[model samples]
Structure formats: structure tokens, C-alpha cells
Target: MSLEQGIVFSVLGITLAMFVWNRLRFDVVAMLALLAVAVAGLVPTEELFAGFGHPAVITVAAVLVISQGLVNGGVVDNIARLLGRIGHRPTLQVLTLTSVVALCSGFINNVGALALLMPVAIWMSREAGRSPSLLLMPLAFGSLLGGTMTLIGTPPNIIIASYRESGTFGLFDFAPVGVAITLAGIAFITLAGWRLTPRREENSADSKLFSVGEYVTELRIPADSPHAGSTLHSLLTTSGDEPDVVVLALIRGEQRLAAPSTYKVLREGDVLLVEADTTSLQTFLDTTGLELAHQAIDDQEAESEGASNNDGLADESRGRNGFRETNGHNDAVGAGDDKAASDPIAKGELHLVEAVIAPESSLVGQTANRLQLRENHQINIVAVARLGHRLKRRLGDIRFNAGDILLVQGFEDSLGGALAELGCLPLAERGLRLGSPRNTALASGIFLASIAVIVTGLLSAPVALVAAAVAMVLVKLLSAAEAYKAIDWSVIVLLAAMIPVGQAMESTGGAGLIAAQMLVLGENLSVASVLVMILVGTTLLSNVVNNAAAAIVVAPIALSLAGELQIASDAVLMAVAVGASCAFMTPIGHQSNALVMEPGGYQFGDYWRLGLPLTVIVTVVAVPVIMLVWT
Candidate 1:
């Protein structure tokens, strides 16, 4: 081997090792590999960044934006709601949800389709009183199966299409092989796959799946509250009709009245700490006209803060400090005790989110009032649940403890930033988003037009999707800020950085060396064995590395193997496509799988119990279809 080939192979080895080790972030690892290759003289320094402009990267980014727009526009959410109405049995629900996710993935990005449907699955699980594990794995696996049905369904197919020397593979070329695999996969999952899922204990450290009723929270009595001037017994009687809604304490002027006497009179400006489910909270709020105590105070503080910034801060500083908070609290103001008297609950996008405090959380040991979370971040911790035990205390007085599940309510737009600031990991329960039929229809139309144009050859895939994303933004289907936030920047960076490194393998003859070695090892084996060998290698590699990176490395080897074996290259390439897209055995294999992991309350080992069988089904079915259709 040449010096360049040797160096490239060594870099590739270390890179693959790091990916499998799962230590560093994959994007960071990919960037390091790119830098290593350039420094090794395998790739020119000038061309290192060229991959950022590559069609594959552009198409992936555009697809992500369009997917997020569809989500924001409520296209997928509407479908999920309709599906929920139709399916009665758990098996039926799994079948319907998984099938729809797969079908959607055939035309759109698989990750996007999975992201949109995951909430629906979680909602169904919550309703059925089943662990999300029963549904999420199937939904994630289904998206992978569905992506195989079209050239644009996955990055590998697009990369494969771009590699074709003759006419590019038609949009529908993948349908025959992909449809067979998808059908077989969907059948196995619905009938047998989900049965293998282990049921996790609801209160286990590994599991956070529980009903909304389990959350303990505090709501304040506004001056207009009907319960004011009534006895504590009267307030509890009016609001605690539902057994799930329990009034635990009353807070008046830094004093906690726990289990107060029934004859105790409730007064204006008093805080009522209660434990209730989501339905009961809404009911109690509507019935008594009590606003979230912290939110009321925070809004007033934000207004004052906004006013001060407007008057004196420089433009850059204003932007920098706009949403900045220190230590999960506002350093500038107290709990805004005086401010709450004036600020009523202004109507806007308020979302109820359940977040688990991470071990390294900054909010630990600090009470909500001490942190001034409401004033600094506009977030109100309405409830706290520790180890399934409810904490009934004044929201301001209860200090946050690590692993405590907090149910916070805040504006829809600020929730992401606030979660980061507080070192909280959001529990996956697909909260409601504001999406209308008009926006949904517009997003659907833009998506269809992009696909139509691509199929008609009016424009290339990347250009068409880019145009669709831009149109979605222009039509206000998604705001400019929303569109930007929708794109997963880490994924984009990984793809851009890895593309040239993949090229280095081909340029330095490393890919050929590997392929030649593979051919020589399999010379005595039958062609069927050779095909399976290629498929198996690609599939295994995909589980450890990025699927696109796996495809880029294996595509050349598959084509080379076909040439040496005197077989149809199309069949071999089809094997590679199937192998690349079917990364079901590990969370790191595909983004769809990882997305469902936490929400489903899954451990790493949980994937293969269901995923292994599904993968076997894909292989057992894909091989014959590839040979029959292509050979």
C-alpha cells in the first residue's frame, strides 16, 4: 500500500473506533477526522471545506427545515390525532402509527417523520397506560424501513444516485425492493416485535413514564379568585372535587400552612400549593381564575427588564443579554413580590413541560424563589415530583433537588433556552403546538410540489427542497426563527466534515484496497454469500457510524465487489442501500432510534431485543428481492 493509503486507513480506523466507543460527540469526532486527513496530506487543505457545499449536505439541511415546518404546521399531528381515533387495540395502534411513520418517511427524511410521530406514540402509550417502550421502538424502526422505499427517503440513496455514472436512478427505482422490505418489517413489528419489549417499572431510575396526575404543583390565588374570603375548606371543596387534585398547603406571607384547619379563611394574594393531574390543573385554573403565581410575577419583572434594556443597553449587549440568566435565576431582581400585584396573566403561548434535573444541574439546592427562575427565564415551576412522591410546599420555598422531576410552564418560544439554562432534560410527551389547518395545508402543498418537481425532473432534489423550505418560511408556515431552530446543526456539521474524509479513502486507493481484500476473502464463496457478506458488513458498520458515512465508504466497495464477482452492480448496490438504511440494532445507528430512547425509558440493550429480529427480517427478505429485481 502507498503511504497515503496507509495513513488514510489508519485515520479511518481511529475514527471508526471513536464512533463505536461513543465517547466524544460524533460531529466533533468527524471534524477531528477531517482535520487529521487534511494534515496527513491525503486531502488538499483548500478542498477540506468543500463538503459543506455538497448536494448531500444541502438536501439534508433543507429536508430538516421542511420537516420542522410540517411539524409546526401540524400536518403530522393532525394525522396522529386521526389515527388515535381509529385504533382501539394496542396492536392496532402500533400497526397504524408505525405504518404511517414508515409511509411518511418514504417521501420525507426518516428522522423528521419519526420526530413528528413520536409524540403521537407517547400520547397513545400514556392513554393506554402502557410504557412508551411498547410503541417508540417500533415507530423508530418503521421510519428506517420506510426510508428505503424512495431514492430521496434516505441520504444513502441520494449518495448512491449521485454515484451513478449513467442516467441517475429514477425517483421510483428504489420502490420495488424497498416496498418488499418495508412490508415485511411492518408485519413482523406489529405481530411479534413489540411483544419482546421489556416493561420498565414506572418509578425506576431508568423510567420516568407516569401520568400527569403524579406531578405536585403550586397555583396562586389572584385577587379576582372566587375562593378568596372563603374558608380553606370551601376552597378545597370547590377545587378538589376530583380525587387527583389535592390541596396540600396554603402559603401566606412566608408562612406555610400545611394541613391547615378547615375553618382557616383563604385570603387574596395567598398561594395554594396543590397536587393534580394535567386535566385537573386546567379545570381548577378555569374554575377559580387562579393564575400561575410565578408566571404572574415573572411577566411583570420581564416587562421592567425589557424597559431598562431598551433605554440604555448597546445593540449587541441587548441581543446578548436578551434571554441570559445566571445560575437558573435572575440575578437582577427579587421574586417581584410588588410586581405581581399589577401584572395579570397576559395571554400568549404557554406550554406545560415536564423536565428532569440532570445530576450536574445548577438549580440544585436552590429554592425556585431564590433562583428567581420566573423573573430571569420566565419559567414557573408549577410542580415538583421526587421519586413518585409529591412535594406540597410553597413554590418559592421548596428547593430544587437533583433527579426531581419539575413540571414548568412558560412561553412556547423560550422553553428550549430555559431548559438549557436550568440543566434540565425534557421528558418526551409531545406537548401541544399551535398549528392551524391553513398552515398545515400550505406546508403539505409546498412539500408535495417539491416532490412533484423532483419526480418530473424540473429541478434537482436539493434545489426543490430548498425552494420548498424558503417558501414555507415566506408563507409564514413557520417563522424565520423557527425554521432556523428546526435544522439540527450538529448533523449538518457532521455530514459536511465527513464528506471529504470519505473522498480521501477513494482518492488514496484505501477503498479499493479494502474491497479487493474483501473479494479475495470471498472468492471461494458463492455469489449469494458474497452479497450477504457485503450487506452484513455495511449493516454492522452503519450501527456504529453515521449512516451516510457508512454508505459513502461501502458504496465504492460494493461496486468493486460486483465487478470482481462478474455480477450485476445494481444488485450489489441495492444490497448496500438496504444495509445502510436498516440500522436498527443500536441507538447510535440512526437518529430516529436515539430520539425515541429517552422518551421510551429505554436502556441501550433494549434496542436489540426487538431490533435484531426486525433486522433479520429485512435481510431475509431484501436479498431475494434485490437479485430478482436487479439481476
Candidate 2:
């Protein structure tokens, strides 16, 4: 290799290794690579942050906002929720969610599209008493397959479009082939790819949905408690080993205090109604000066209580006898009247959940009260987590941050639809996760119209996308605050950092070098083989690095190769775009895949079983389609 190639490859290799190790944030790692490359004189100092301003970067941000708007408006969630209830008949749910993901990814950033639905998928898997790992891989694969259809759907496509604009290709040139490949790929996934996804023989399904001991426990407050004289503080804190625990009620006298707060000081004989780990509860009680309130411990009691089928749901625990747990005794009375336990599926009832807020959420600065989240939307904000640290809950008072995780409780419907509307990302659960109902059609219309106008060449693509983003804010599909919250800065940072690297490659003829490598491989190969090789190479890169960054790095080569080979540049660029999105072999390949991993209890190797075949199928389907359409 030449000195420049060696230097560039050395940098790329180190950055990629760190990215896969995940010891450092991908954005931070990419930025470091940018700085190192510039300092080494392999990259221009002035152009280091160019990728940040690149159209692909901006479009990804805008599409995230649109996806949030769709979630806020309840357009996508409504359909996602419908699919959740159709039963755990694994095949049906997999196909349903995979199809939904594919279609959604066509318009929105696939990660954002997947994040909005991921929680719902996990919830549904649990509800149907199945291991979530079985379905998450399929959902991720569907998202990757679906991302191929449109220009803005995946980063590779956007990069391809930008390259095409440099006199390489025409608009709509790749759509026919993309559409064909997408259909055939979807079929392969639904029929065969899903079968390859292995399921662990989980004795209990709740293990996939609940953190197990993360919720079961005991809590005790000391005698002579300060709370004896104080009201539950207006501020609430939801941080604990028990993620599901929120102070629902406190008992001093027979009266119950529902939704007690940080301000509530301690008092003697006060029993705290909390969710906690059984072992941790004793230690916590000893540490806090509280004693365990004993329940009769015997086989008769256990047998009489009966076993529960709701995956350790607190509600099912109470249905055994007249005994029930409630935040406030009065609320329990209300629940008693409502009989929420009768049917766990359809009732508009209270539930506890965790969700992460997307980037730049409008709720960042506003107090939860300012949003009137509970009154206007009917969902309760139990707690908020900024970055990974749980914040002190003034709840109504805490400013929401992009990437903040939220602990919430409320009617499922309101939480599903309205949570997005309230400028929050509900942690993916597997039930029928719905979105806000207030503005579904309006948001969908504006988003689609932006594409229509762009396709008709009436407005520039950037302006059309920006208009859709702004209209979402104006129409209150998302508030100005919410619109900003929806944008992912990590992605933005990664793009900005990598753009200069791409420029450097083009400047040093690095792109030409890679293209030459591919051309050599395809010397006697047909057009289809050339396209497949390019697509496969891009796919492999995406599997190890950020999908967007992969696209930025490889795009110049797709263009360079097209020119050198005397082929239709658009067709070659489209091939690059498809490969960039097909990173199904690893969880680190896409944010959507990462987002689902912990929640679904998925192992790293589990994906390849399903994803490898899917990649092959896409290759088989796409190569010929490109030959037929682009040639």
C-alpha cells in the first residue's frame, strides 16, 4: 500500500475496532479519528467537520423528527399496537412487525423508526408469553430490508443521491430496482429468515420483559420519621435497584397518600408501598430504619394465592384475593370500581414503563407541568433519567434531555400515543404500544407531501425535507421543543466527523483505490456481479461501524467505480446504498439493533442466524434487479 493508504487504513482500523468494542461512544471515537487524521496531515483541517453539514446528516436529523412526529401523532404506533394484540403466533407477529418496520424505514431514519416500535415489540413478545429474542432480530432485519426503497430512508441512499447529483446519476433511477429487491427480500425474510431465528426455551416469559429481581422487594422507614410531619414532596425520585418501583402510596393512618414525593419525610409506623428486590428490600429497610411488615409465610398461603400468568404483573398478584396493592387506597377503590384486572389487554389502565427521550426534545427546558402532560395527555411521568444517570424528579419540574430515559405510569393508550406528543420516548415495551391520537393524519400527510413535492422536482430535496420538519412543529405534530428533541445528535456528530474523511479519501484518491480493488475483482465479471460485490462490501462495513459513517466512507468509491467501469452511476450508487443498510449480522451495526439487544435479551451471535441468510437473499434479489432496471 502507498503511504497515504497505509495511514488512512491504520486510522480507519483503529477507529473501527474501538467502535466494535463499544468502550467509547461511536461519535467520540469517530471525532477522535477525524482529529487524528487532520493532525497527521492526511485530512484538511478546514474540512474536518464538513460531514456535519452534509445533506445526508441533515436529512437523517429531519427524518428522526418526522418519525417522532409520527409517533407523537400516533400514526405508526396505532398500527404497531394493532399488530401486538394479534397473538404470539411467532410467524404472524414477526411478519407483521418486520413488514411495518420495512415500510416505516422507507420514510424515516431506520434507527428512529425502529426505536419508536422496539418497546412495543418487546411488550408484545412478553404478552404473548414468548422470548423477545425470537422477534427482535426479525424486526431489525425487516428494518434493514425496508430501508432500501427510498432516498431518505437510509444514510447510504442519501449519500448515493448526493453522489448522483455530482453528474453520476438521475433521480428515481434506482427506485424500480429498489422496489423489486425490497419485495423479494421481504418474502425471503418472512418465509425463511424468521425460521432461522432461534428461541431460547425460557421457562418463564417475564424474564425477557422484566429485569426479574429488579422489581420484587421490601422497603422500611424508621420510627420518628421526618415524613411523619411532611407531605410527599412535590418532587419525586424514581432511581432504585427496582426500576419499576415508584412511591405509589404511603400509610401512616388508614389513609393512603398516593404518588408520594421526595419531600415526604419519614415517620414511625409508616408503610411505604414500593416495588423492590426481595433480598434488597431487607437490606434497604435496615439501612433506612424501617422494619418488614410480615405476611403469613407458609405453603397454604402460597397455594391459596395461586400462580400468576401475567408475567409477574403486580395486578395479577392482587386478583387472587380481595387484597390488592395500590398507590393510594382511594385510587385502589377507583381501580376496584373499574375492575382493571378483568382483561389485561384492552383496558385503559395504569402501567409502569421506562422510555428514552430522543435528541433535542422540546421537553429539554420546559417543566413537565408546563407541558401539562398528565392533564392534557393522561400519562403520568414517574421519573426521568438523563443520559444514564437518574435525575431527581421534580417530574413536572425536570427538564427533559435528548437520550434521557423516563419512568412512567398511566393508561396504556395515553402513554403510547401521547407520550411522543409530550416530548418523551417511551422505552420500548412489547404490548400494543400506541402513539398520541391528536394529530396522526396531519403529520403523515405533511411528511408524505414533502416527498411528493421533492419527487415532482417542485422543490429541492433539502428544502422539502426541512419544510416537512418545520410544518410538523407548526401544526403541533411536535412542538418546536419536541421537534428539536427528536433529532439524534450522536448521528449528527458522527456524520460531521466523517465527511472530512470522505473528502480526504477523494483528495488522496483513496476512493479510486478502493474502486480499483473492486474493478479488479469484476474484471471479467458481469454487471450483476460487479453490483453484488459492491453491495456486499458496503454491507460488511456497515456491520462493524455506524451505518451512516459506512455510507459516507464508501460512497465516493461507488461513484469512482461507476465512472471507471463505464456503467450507469446511479445503478452503482444504489447498490452501495442497499449494502450500507443491510448490516443484519451484528447488533453493533445499527442503533436499532443496539436499542433492542438488552430489552430483548439477545446475544450477539443470535442475529447472524437470521441476518446472514437475509443478506444473501438481498444480494441474490438485488443484483439481477439492478441489471434489469439500471442497465
The TM-score values for the models, in the order shown, are 0.72, 0.76
Model 2 bad stretches (over 4 Å): 1-6, 41-46, 84-89, 123-128, 165-172, 202-208, 211-249, 254-263, 284-289, 293-350, 354-438, 517-521
lDDT of 2 by residue, 447-477 (tens): 8798789878888777778889989888877
> What's the alpha carbon RMSD for model 2?
7.5
Candidate 1, residues 1-631, lDDT tens digits: the string is: 9999989888888988998896667789899999999888888888999989988788878887888788778887677667668554878988998899999899777876876677677667766667777888899899999999987788888777766656667778999999999999999999888898767545432233333323445577778777889986576557545233545445677554443445678888887655565566677677767776566445565688763322211122321211123222211111233342222223334445666675335787888757767557767676777645556555556777655777776655677668855767565533545478888888899999998998999998888889999999999887888777666677788888888888898888777788789878988987778878888889999998888878877887787777777878888888888998999888779878766665566777888899888888888899988888888
Question: In candidate 1, which residue ranges exceed 4 Å CA deviation?
Answer: 201-351, 355-377, 380-406, 411-434
Tell how far residue 183 is off in model 1, in angstroms: 0.6
Candidate 2, residue 33: Cα displacement in angstroms equals 2.6
